[model samples]
Target: MISTTVAAVVTRFAPSPTGQLHAGHAFSAIRAHDFARERGGRFLLRIEDIDPGRSRAVFVKGIEDDLRWLGLGWDGEVVHQSARFEAYRGALGALGSAGLLYPCFCTRADIAQAASAPHGPEGLFYPGTCRALDPAVRERRMESEPHAWRIAMDKAVEQTGRLHWHDEETGEVTADPLRFGDVVLARKDAPASYHLAVTVDDAWQRVTDVVRGADLFEATHIHRLLQALLGLPTPRYHHHPLLTDAGGERLAKRRGSESLANLRENGADPAALAEALRRGEMPAL
Candidate 1:
C-alpha cells in the first residue's frame, strides 16, 4: 500500500514507446519530475507498451535516452505494461465477475458509422450495442469471435454511487464516466485498454499524484470510476496545459513533431532546453 502520510507525494510519468519523445512529452515529463522532486516525493517511470503491433523495443530505449538527455531521472526500476498481462487479466476478471464487463465486438468503423452514436471528447462514443446481448449468444460469440471488453457504465455507476476526484487545476470534480458510455476495459488486440491498465498500475504502484497533459482531463472521470470499482485509492491529478506549435496545433507524434533526438543532433543543449521548457518558452519546431 502507498504511504498516505501528508508528506508522501508520489508521481509518475508514463509514455507509450510508439515513437520518439517530442517537446510536448519533454514538457510533461519535466512537470511530473519537478513536482515530485521539488516536494521530496518519489517520481516513477512506466513504459506503456500495451499495443504489441505498434510498440517497439528500440523506441523504449529511445524514451529512456531522451529522458536522460532532458535531465529527468525517475525513482526505482521502470515498469512495463507488456510484462504485466496477467495482472491486467486479473483486473478484467474482477470486473467481469462483478457483471460490469460485457463483450464488445464492434469494430472502430462500426462505431464511427453508427449515426446514432453521440460524440464525446475522444470523438464518437460507443452506443452500447452489445451490452444487451443475450447471455447465451454472448457466450457463444466469446467462444469463436475476438471481442473487446467494455464496462457496463450505468451498472458500474450504480454500484459505486456518486464519485468524484480532486484535480490540482479544476479542484474537486464529479466523475461522469457515462459520458464515455461503455468504455472498453480490454481491447481485442491488447490485454487491457488504457483505462484499465492505468488505473490498475497506479494503484499497484501506490501512486499518490497523477501528472499529465490536459488532453487527458476527461479521461480521469472514467479512471476515478474504475478506482472506486476496484477499491483502489484515488490519486490527486494535475492536468497541465499542452504544448502547441506556432500554428496552435498540439504537438503530436502523428503530426511528425520535432523529437528530442532531432534537437540533440541539432546541437541543442539539454540544460538550456530544460530551462526554456520550465520557463514556458515555445520551441521553434
Candidate 2:
C-alpha cells in the first residue's frame, strides 16, 4: 500500500506548446499548484512538445506568460519533451530488447478502413498486422520500413500480474488490458506519444502526484501500463472537473474560446476568473 501522507508531493503542469492556454488549462494549473503548495510540495512546469510539427517556441513563450499572469510559480526550470527524444529512444530500446515493443506499419487510411470494416472506433484497433510476423519477416520489414512502435500488451500483462494505480481523488483504480488492448508507444512521425512522454517525464522529474482534468481519467490505464513496463514509480493522480463553455462543450485552445489571453483582453480579473471557473461559470470568451 502507498503512503497517504506524502513526504513531498511533486506535481506538474505539463501543457502541449501546440496552442494557447485556456480557462481549462488555468484551472488545472492553479489546482495542481494549490495542491502542491497545500502539502508543502514541489510544483513543476513541463513542456509537452513531442509533436514537433505543431509545437512552437512562440506557443511555449505564450504558456509561460499565461502561467505567470495567473500568479503560478513552479519549482524548477521548465522541461521540454523535444529535448528528451534520446531518453524516449532508450526506453523504447529497452522495451524492444524485452520483446515488449513491436513496429506498427498500419497507415491512418488503412486503420480507418479496417475500423470501418469492423465498425469500431474511428481508427483501426491495430489489427496486429505486424505483430505476428516471423523473425525473418520482421527483420526484413524493420530493415526496409518506417513504422510506429506499439507496446506488446500480451508480454506486459504476462510480466505484470495485474495493472492498477491509486488515484489521489478517485481512489483505487484498475484496468483490464483485454478491454483497452495494446497502445502505441511512439509514432513513426512523432517519436513519443503522449503516454510514453508523460510517464517518462514524471519519473524523470520524481513527480509524486499528478493533477489534471477529469477528461483524461481513462488514460490512467495507459500510464499505469507504461509505469509497470518502464519500472517507474506511479504517482498519485488527481483529475479535476473540466471547464466548459456555455454550450456545454469543453473549452479548447484550438477552438479559440475562453482563452486566458482573450479573458485578459476583455479586462477579466484573475481572481474573479479563478473563482468563476471554480463555480463552473462560462466565462465570456
Candidate 3:
C-alpha cells in the first residue's frame, strides 16, 4: 500500500509498447524521474501493452534501453498491463455489480453515422444507443455478440458526488468526467480501456504523483471519478507542456517523430540530450 503521508512521493513513467521513445516521451519520463528523485521518493516504470494487436515485445525492450541510455533508472520490477487482466476483470466486476456499467455494442461506424452524436475530448462521444437497452436484450447480446463495457457516467457521478484532483501547475481543479459520455471501461477487443487500466495501475502501484503530457489533462477527470468509485487514492498530477518539433507539431509516433534510437545511431550524445531535457530545453535534432 502507498503511504498517505505528504512526504513520501511515488511516480511512474508508463509507456505503451506500440512505438519508439521520441523526444516528447523523453521529456515526460525525465519529469517524472526528476520529480521522484528530487523528493527522495520511488520512481517506477510501467508498460502499457494492453493492446495486443498493436503492441510488440521488441518495442518494450527498446523502451527500457532508451530510458537506460538517458540515465533514468526506475525502482523495483516493471509493471505490465497485459499481465493484469484478472485485476481489471475484478474492477469491471465491481462496477458492474453496482449497476454503474452497461454493455455498449455500438461500433465506430455506427456512432459516426448517428446524426445526434456529440463530440468530446477523446473524439465523437458515444451516442449511448445501448445505455437504456432492455435487460433481456443486454443479456442476449452478452451471450452472443461481443460488446464493450461503458460506465454510466450520470450514475457514477451521482454516487461519487463532486470530485476534484490537484495539479502541480494548475492547483485544484474540478472534475468533469461527463465530457466523455458513457466512456468505455472495457473494450470489445481488449480486456480494459485506457481509462480503466491507467486508473487501476496507479492505485495498485501506489503512485503518489502522475506526470505526463498536457494532452492527458482532460482524462484526469475520468480517472479521478474512477478512483472514487473503486476506493482508490487520488494522486497529485503534473501535466507538463508537450514537446514539439520546429514546425510546431507535437512529437508523436504516428507522425514518425525521430526516435531516441535514431538519435543514438546518428552519434548524438545521450548525456547532452538528457541534460537538455532536464533543463526543459529541446536538444538539437
Candidate 4:
C-alpha cells in the first residue's frame, strides 16, 4: 500500500518521445523538480510514447540524457506509456461496459461538413453523430467496420460533476465542462489517446501533482472529468509559463529551438541553464 505521507508530494514529468527536449520542456521539468524538492516530494519521469508514428527510441534516449545533463533526477524506474497499452484498453473496456463510450464513425471532413456553421479552437466541434446510435446498430457497425471511440459528453456531464483544478501559479481554480465535451479517448490508429494514457499513467504512478505549461490549463478540465469518471484521485496542477522564441512564438522541437543538448554541446553550465530557464531566457545553444 502507498503511504499517505503529506511530506511526499508526488509529481511527474511526462514527455513525449517524438522530438528533442526544447527550452520549454526544460522549464517545465525544472519547475516540477523544484516543487518536489521544495516539499520533500517525489519526482517521476514518464515517457508518453503512445504516438507510434512519431515516437522513437532514439528520441526517448535523448530526453533521458538531456534531463540528466540538466542535473535533474527522478525517483524509481521510468514508465513508458507504450508498455501500458493493456491498462488503457482495460480502462476503455470498463467505460464501454458502463455505456459511457461509443464508436464514432465521423471523419474530420464529416464533422466539418456537419458544422458548416462556426466553431472554436481546433476546428468544427465534434457533432454527437454516434451518441444517438442504438447499441445493436453500433455493435453491427463495429463488427463490420473500423471506427474511433469517443466518450459520450452528455452522459459524462450528467454522471460526473463539474471539473476543476487548482493552478499553482495563477492561484485560481477554474471549472468549465462546456469548453470540453466528448473528447476522444482512443483513435483509430492508436487504441489510447492522450487523455486516457495520461490519466492511467498518473494513477498508476500515484502522481499527486502535475506540472506542465499554461497552454494545457484548459485541457485540465477534460482530464479531471476523466479522473472522476474512472474513479481515480485528482492531482494538484502547476501550469507554468512557456518559453518562446525571438519571433514570440512558442518554442518547438521542429523549429530547431535551443535544446538542452545544443546548450551542453556549447559547453554551457547546467546550473546556469536552469537559472536561465527560471528567468524565461533561452539558454545559449
The top-ranked prediction according to lDDT is 3
Clashes of each: 0, 0, 0, 0
What TM-score do all the candidates reach, one by one? 0.96, 0.91, 0.97, 0.91
Candidate 3 yields a Cα-based lDDT of 0.92
In angstroms, the error of model 2 at 145 is: 2.4
lDDT tens digits, residue span 4-111, model 4: 344468988999998889878999999998889898889999999999999999999999999999889999999999899999999999898888888998788878
lDDT of 2 by residue, 1-285 (tens): 223244688999999988788888988888888889998999999999998789899999988988887788899899999999999888888788898888887777876666433432222466666787887887888788888998877778888778778876778988655445557889888777898988888888888989999988887787888788778888888888788777888878667765677667778788777776566675565
Error of 4 at 126 (Å): 0.3
* Alpha-carbon local distance difference test for all models: 0.91, 0.80, 0.92, 0.82
* Model 2 global lDDT (CA atoms, 0 to 1): 0.80
User: What TM value does model 3 have?
Assistant: 0.97
Candidate closer to the true structure by TM-score (higher is better), 1 or 2: 1
CA-only RMSD, every prediction: 1.5, 3.0, 1.3, 2.3
- The residue pairs in collision within model 1 are none
